[model samples]
Target: MSTTSDLGTHGERIAAAYLTDRGLRVLDRNWRCREGELDIVAREGDALVFCEVKTRRAVGFGHPAEAVGHAKQRRLRTLAQRWLAAHDEHAPDLRFDVVAVLVRAGRPALVTHLRAAFS
Candidate 1:
């Protein structure tokens, strides 16, 4: 894979581990539809979390989380609805999160998890 795609995949794996360590159970990764893709789907207690992961080697443009702006947030919301429609057994308790990962020299320098990132 290309460097950018590799970094994104690495970041998602790391993010999954980090969340699972904190008691969240991973339900899916890279879930895609015609609308878009969801980086991670997990359950934290009673809530279903739809996560967007942004990975970067440097922040020359902006922080990784900043990449998930309004447009992306809107898309995530719509995608979440699509996901829910496909899985009717899930509870309505839902949350949107953003995980920002910064890599340096092929190692993760920082990973930030922001829960309830948007409505």
Candidate 2:
């Protein structure tokens, strides 16, 4: 079994590839702020998307999307605001997305995309 960090890294890779295949240009990986971390920042047709990637070994800990509680959402929002402030330019349409990766034997077994995951 790979380490948790390794699983996270693999999940990010899978997510990036998935988004790229869908024509979303990835801008950044692991964008961080005082509030929290954003796994990926991407551009899709003039829209800025802040993506959260959750990786789990199985369903034992519950669904990955369910792990993102209200507090996490608030922090994500704060991080997104800081990201936009730092990358000040024309404000593109902003959105939040959640990509859950189910890993089994160190490989991605399933992937779920939740668009506009939070407010």
Candidate 3:
């Protein structure tokens, strides 16, 4: 991708497809609020899943998943609550997931799905 946003958008698309292929029905994408944006929202059976997608052209700094530290996780949790409130959606269980995409030149992007990444 030419820009970071483009790469991120591409990664989100791949992550959504990956989740669908794994049987999670996608509910929302790029859900935004005054707080922040949620990369993906999905469901698997009776559980509601909130996914954070991180994309990087290289891992010189660290893995993409590493980008979602405690602060980000906290924000995501708040966003999830807001999402539920806005949609009036209920689930017996809630989960947080992280989809890390590593793009390499001339090679397929590597995907790592960390389920229940944080509380």
The candidate that wins on lDDT is 3
Off by over 4 Å in 2: 106-108
Task: Give the alpha-carbon lDDT of every model.
Answer: 0.89, 0.86, 0.96
TM-score of each: 0.92, 0.90, 0.97
Candidate 2, residues 44-86: lDDT per residue as tens digits? 8878988999988789879877888898888888998888887
Full candidate order by TM-score, most accurate first: 3, 1, 2
Candidate 3: tens digits of C-alpha lDDT, residues 1-119: 89999999999998999999999999999999999999999999999999999999999999999999999999999999999999977999999999999988899889999999999
Best by TM-score: 3
RMSD value for candidate 3: 0.7
Residue-level lDDT tens digits of model 1 in 1-119: 37888989988988898889889999989989999999999998889999999988889999999999899999999999988888754866899999898877855568899999888
lDDT, residue 93, candidate 2 = 86
User: Which has the higher lDDT value, candidate number 1 or candidate number 2?
Assistant: 1
